[model samples]
Target: MIEINLDVVMLKRHISSKELAKRIGITQANLSILKNNKAKGIRFNTLEKICKELNCNPGDIIKRIS
Candidate 1:
């Protein structure tokens, strides 16, 4: 399974969902879905924006488990 580690990075950066949503130009509800691993998938452009805002790589926000 793939795990979305968004909350970990958000906590590390001390950013709130509202702030991140505004920064990434996404809705807070969408960000919440992503944060809680309820998202079915994410666009690469969105991922790029998130990484840029959070100052982290994709790997920092995603992980794979067996």
Candidate 2:
């Protein structure tokens, strides 16, 4: 399974969901879906924006576990 560690990275960076959403040009509601792991899929462009704003690699936010 793939687990998203977005909350962890957000905490490490001391960023709020609203703030990140604004920076990434996405709505807070959509961001919440992603953060809460309820998202069915994510767009690559959106992922790129997130990585850019959070200054993190995709691997840092998305983890594969067995």
Candidate 3:
């Protein structure tokens, strides 16, 4: 399974969900879905925006697990 570590990175960056969502040009609800690992997939454009806003890489947000 793929796990989203968005909440962890956000905390490390001292950024709030609301701010991140707005900066990434995505709805708070959609961000919540990603943060909570309820999202089935994420667009590359959206991922790029998130990485840009957080100053992090895709690996910092997602991971694979057994």
lDDT top scorer? 1
lDDT of 2: 0.96
lDDT of 1 by residue, 39-61 (tens): 99989999999999999999999
Candidates by TM-score, descending order: 1, 3, 2
Candidate 2 local lDDT, 1-66, one digit each (tens): 888999999999999999999999999999999999999988999999999999999999999999
lDDT of 3: 0.95
Pick out the ten consecutive residues of candidate 3 with the lowest summed lDDT: 17-26
The collision pairs in model 1 are none
State candidate 3's TM-score. Answer: 0.97
Ten contiguous residues with the weakest lDDT in model 1 = 34-43
Against the reference, the lDDT scores of all candidates come to 0.97, 0.96, 0.95
| Error of model 3, residue 10, in angstroms | 0.2
| Candidate 1: stretches off by over 4 Å | none
lDDT of 3 at 19: 98
**Candidate 2, superposed: residue stretches over 4 Å from native:** none
Query: TM-score per candidate, in order?
Result: 0.97, 0.96, 0.97
